[model samples]
Target: MFYKEIFSFIAIAITLAAFIPYIREIFRGTIRPHIFSWVIWGVTTLLIFVAQLEDHGGVGTWPIGVSASITIFIAYLAFIKRADVTITCGDWLFFIAALLSLPLWYWTSDPLWAVILLTAIDVAGFGPTVRKAYQFPYSESLLFFALFTLRNVLVMLALENLTLTTLLFPAVMLVLCILMMAMIAYRRRVLFA
Candidate 1:
């Protein structure tokens, strides 16, 4: 129990550490996050937090709740600041797909199914960000994602229930963040080369 609390706190700290810089960069107009991605992540993350709580996620879910709030704020900022408003057809497809998935999750009876649906949507939500990052490699923050990857691991470790619903999102996000960082690095090198 003590270890869970500690892990949760540390994970929460890392969430703030990661997002603070990304938020700072957004205000500085250095990092232009995709609005679609943020909205999907924010909504799904919040829903996942709720699912985790019901599934006995304990203190670990706190960071996810915190992240969801921050993510929604970032989405608002992205919309208002007009950061990367270049919406392509594919971007619209991703956005639309995310919207469509919401109903599926909402109708889901099982927490696991809801988490799975939301998690998949959250992952697919990466489309616009990945697309944008590929085109403008330096526009995204590598360090933020690195911290996120670590945070997800801590989140998993902090989980009290250890159920599939409780662990799946962070587990998947852990992999996604690593892959995202790798893709960004490759894009940076290729573009710079």
Candidate 2:
């Protein structure tokens, strides 16, 4: 019980560690976050956190809850700073798909389906940021993604319940973060080469 709580807090701390600098970069105009991606991520993340709590995830959901707010704030910052506000048709597709998850989740009356749908939408949400990172490898902070990956791992470890509902979101996010990090590194190398 105590260990789970500690791990949960540590994960939250890591989230802060990762996001504070990322936010600073945004303010400094060093990192250009895609508005659509952050908005989708924010909405999905908050919903996923609710699903986790419904599944008795307990303390593990804390980091995700914190991330949700930060993600939304980043989206707001992107909009205000006029960073990557380009609304591609595909971006609209991703956003709409993400919004649909909520109604689908409500209709199903199952947190699992919600997590699954939201996770898929969240994955799709990565498309714009992934494209941006591929085009301008220098615009993202790889370390932020790395820390986020680590934070997800910690979140998984801190989970009180080991059910799929509690585990799926962080598990998938962990994989996604790793893949994103890998793609960013490869893009940086290929672009500079």
Candidate 3:
């Protein structure tokens, strides 16, 4: 019980802290976010928040909920600032597909399947960001992604159910975060070298 509370608080704090620098950098015009990616993330995170609540009703899910809210705000900032915004046609297609999947998720009988579909869409949404990161790596904040990966780890530990439905999203996000971080680092090195 005590450990759960501790991990929950830590996860939420780290998740929020991770975004602070990213948001600050965005305002400072240091890190320019891919608007498509942020928009997709904002929507996907909100869906994941709903799925998490259904799969695991505990304090661990609070971080995801908070993250969803923050993601929306960041998306708004990205839209308004329009810094390094890259939105290809395919990116629009992916977003539409993801948005369309919400109905499919609602039509599904299994909660786990709904979560799985949402996670797949979320992963697919990363394509735009991955392409952007490959082209312009410095536009992203590596520290923010690193901290997010850590927060996901803590949130995973805090989960009470530990089922596939509950575990898959965060686990996938952790890997994606690490991949994005590595891509940014490698691209930065190659470009700057």
Candidate 4:
């Protein structure tokens, strides 16, 4: 148990370390290299593997990894190529905020509080990105929002102890889906009109 715990902690640390510099560049208004971004994401996927292998939550890991990998790849293809739409200061702020919540997630004994806090941070952090994605639907930025919403929903459901706040996460996800669909419809009408 001790070794597994330590390894889990180390894996988390490595992921965060790889993520920090990319995040710093986002603050400086520079997009990370697609390859570098992929590395970070790959590491994250691996983290999920370790988490599950250690029995932290095995079945849930696969969906999270698949969603994240697809989202990252699509996001890279869509936005990383455009200099003007590269990572911005707001993006970094949100990224860091989300990452900061992970330690809290690991440490908290109360699963309900952890879920609530993590869900809130994720949604809030992703808000700016989601707005930007909506404005530029053709860009890969849109993929992350979809993935983010999915991830939140899946994680909430995966929790063994279903809490009241878990319901809130899915409700929020439903609203996001509705809002995104509405935005797409509005944009299409505007363009065609």
Candidate 5:
């Protein structure tokens, strides 16, 4: 029990530390995060955090709850910065789908389904950022995603009770973070070469 609390606090600290530099970069106009991506991430993370709290009784949810809060702040920064980039129609489509999924999950009242759907929405929301990162690799931070992957792993390890609802979101996030890191790396390689 003590170990679980320690792990939870560690996860929370690492998660916040990971985002601080990313947020600073965004504020410095070095990283131009997609508004749609951050917005969906904020909302979906909040939902997942709530589901995790209900399912795990806060054992492994502190990091997720903190992440959701930071995501909201980053989303606001992205919105205000308004980088010199265009938001494609497909991005809007994904955003709408993400918004619609929330109510559907609420209506279903299944934490498992909620996490699954939210995970899907969260990945879909990354579409625009993925596209943008492909074009401008430096527009995103590799360190942030890498640390997020680590944070997810820590959160998973910190889980006192593991279930589909508790595991799905972190697992999906870990994969997505890896994919995003790969995308950024590929873009950097191609752009610099």
Candidate 6:
């Protein structure tokens, strides 16, 4: 049980690690808006980690403390530093998907199936969500969401021991991400008049 929890935590950490560059870019903006969203996700990740540790027993929830601190910093970025970025339609969609997945995550006994369901909904919704975010020239937002969806897909693959057929989803997502970025870039240049 403990190892299972550790595996999940590590998977999530690896996913977050992949986005470090994007996160840095977001912060480096003149005003670091969107920190709230980042911090909220971070805290949720930490809580999941803590809950796992508790289930494992005797480990305590140190990771939660660290995550709380990170969230505080994020709050400071969002509130104190005045990084108030507007949320796009896609961002709201992603948020809604996450919320909708909560019950499925809790009620489902089969973790793999549950993850697959979550990933499916995310992939289905992602294209439109990303396209909407790109409307604001929020390329980083799109990339960030893409990375997130990639992370979830990867997690499902890893946890489920999916066969070759499982590769389809990620391949499709990669293509979509590329095409979306290209379209956005092209429009940015053409529409700047």
Model 6 ranges off by over 4 Å: 1-18, 30-84, 88-94, 124-132, 138-160, 164-176
Tens-digit lDDT string for candidate 6 (1-193): 3553454465456456644555475578632445435444444444343333433322223333344455456556666555545666666766576656655645655444443554455354444434443564554444554654555444434433233223333444456666656665666776686
Put down candidate 5 lDDT per residue, 39-148, tens digits, no spaces.
99999999989988878646688899999999998888888888535788888888888888768778767788888888888888888888888888898889999998
Best by lDDT: 1
Per-residue CA lDDT of model 4 for 1-193, tens digit only, reads 3443343344333334434444454445543233333333333433433343344453333444454455365346435554334566666666666566557656756545554565565455445545554556443223333444555455444544333533444456446655665675566567678
Model-by-model lDDT, in order? 0.94, 0.89, 0.84, 0.47, 0.86, 0.48
RMSD of model 2, in Å?
Answer: 1.1
Task: Look at candidate 4 and give me any clashing residue pairs.
Answer: none
What TM value does model 1 have? 0.98
Q: Over the stretch 94-163, how does candidate 3's per-residue lDDT look in tens digits?
A: 7788777767777777768878888898887888778877888887888999999999998888887788
lDDT of 1 by residue, 1-193 (tens): 8999999999999999999989999999999999999999999999999999988899989999999999999999999999988999999999999989898987888999999999999998999999999899898999999999999999999999998999999999999899889999999899879
Please report the TM-score between candidate 2 and the true structure. 0.96
Off by over 4 Å in 2: none
Residue 171, model 6, lDDT: 44
Tens digits of per-residue lDDT, candidate 2, 1-193, equal: 8999999999999999999999999999999999888988998899899998998999999999999999999989998998886667877877777776657766668888889988888898898888888888888999998999999999999999898898998989889889989998999889779
TM-score of each: 0.98, 0.96, 0.94, 0.48, 0.95, 0.46
Top model by TM-score, which number?
Answer: 1
Model 5 misplaced stretches (Cα beyond 4 Å): none
lDDT-based ranking: 1, 2, 5, 3, 6, 4
